[model samples]
Each structure stands twice: as C-alpha cells, then as structure tokens.
Target: EAGVAQSPRYKIIEKRQSVAFWCNPISGHATLYWYQQILGQGPKLLIQFQNNGVVDDSQLPKDRFSAERLKGVDSTLKIQPAKLEDSAVYLCASTGTSGVHEQYFGPGTRLTVT
Candidate 1:
C-alpha cells in the first residue's frame, strides 16, 4: 500500500501570516488525523476525522486553525494570522477503520514562523 502524501514539505512565514497544508491519505482509510509536533516534544493530536465528519478537535486551535476532509479522502489544514509559537511540524496520519490501531503518517510539513 502506498503511504500518505503531503505537499510542500516545508514552509516559512512571518508572524500573523497565513498558510495551508494538504494531505492525501491511503486509499480506503476511513480515519484521518492531524498532529502538531513542536521541537523537543512528542506529536500532539490536533484533530481527527472519520470520513467527512470530524471526530474530535478539542486540541485544535480553532481561533486561527481550521481543517477539512470534504470528500473523506483528501484533507487540508489552514492557519490564518499564524503566530511565532506555531512553528512546528504538521503531520498527517490515517488508519484503515475504527478498529484499526496502527496509523500511517506522512512526511510532515515543517512550518517556521519568523
């Protein structure tokens, strides 16, 4: 099976700028997730989607961050008016089904807010 795909492996922006990242998960995977990994810390779950419906987003910074999986396949995450503290790696991951515990992650998009 092919791995999850993400675009623009790196991004650099100034404070209060806007940026977006895209992800294409493995075929047939029903669950998708986004995570933020700050330097020196483990990845933190940002949001999760089951098909086109959001399963969880309690950790997401909704004031400036948003995400969508409109077709249940591809997803996009956007941050508007980004902050310097937002510098981190944004990771996309997917799993086969509700019962599946193993998640395959994409090569994350690294963001640097200057």
Candidate 2:
C-alpha cells in the first residue's frame, strides 16, 4: 500500500503571512490525524478525523490554524497570519481500523518562519 504523501517537504514563510499544506492518507484507512511537532518535542495532536467527521480538535489553535478533511479522504491545514513560533513540522498520519491503532506518518512539511 502507498504511504502517506505530502508536498513541499520544506517551507519558509515570514510572520503574519499565510501558508497551506496538503496531505493524502493511505487508501482504505479509516482514521486520519494531523499533528504539529516543534523542535526537541514530541508531536502534538492538532486535529483528528474518523471518516468525514471530526473526532477531536481540542488542541488546534482556532485563531490562526484551520484544517479540514473533506470527502473523508484528503486533508489540508492552513496557518494564516503566521507567527514566528509557528515554525515547525506538520505531520499527517493514518491508520487502518482492523488492526492495532498505530499510525503511519508522512515525512512531514517543515515550516520555517523568518
């Protein structure tokens, strides 16, 4: 099966600018998740989706970050009016429902704010 796919493996943007990232999860996976990982820290869950409906987004910063999983498949995450601290790795992961719930992750989009 194909692993998760993401574009622009690296990005650089200035503060207060807007940037968007895209993701394509593995086919047949029932659950998908997006996470933000800062340097020297573990990935933090930003949003999670089960099919087309969102299961959790408690950690997402609603003021500047927004995400969606339309058609219960592909997903996109956007950061508008970005801040210096917003620089980090945005990861997209997926898991199949029939087995262990461990997730498979993409190489991630690394954003650097200047």
Best by TM-score: 1
TM-scores of the candidates in the order shown: 0.97, 0.96
C-alpha displacement of 110 in model 2, angstroms? 0.3
Candidate 2's C-alpha runs over 4 A off are none
**Model 1 TM-score (2 dp):** 0.97
TM-score of 2: 0.96
Report the lDDT tens digits of candidate 2 across residue range 5-88: 987799999999999999999998878899999999999999999987899999999999999888899899999989999999
The residue pairs in collision within model 2 are none
Candidate 2 lDDT trough over 10 residues, lowest sum: 93-102
The sequence of per-residue lDDT tens digits that candidate 1 reaches over residues 1-114 is 899999989999999999999999999999999999999999999999999999999999999999999999999999999999999999999998667799999999999999
Off by over 4 Å in 1: none
lDDT, residue 5, candidate 1: 99
Clashes of each: 0, 0
In model 1, what is the error at residue 67, expressed in angstroms? 0.3
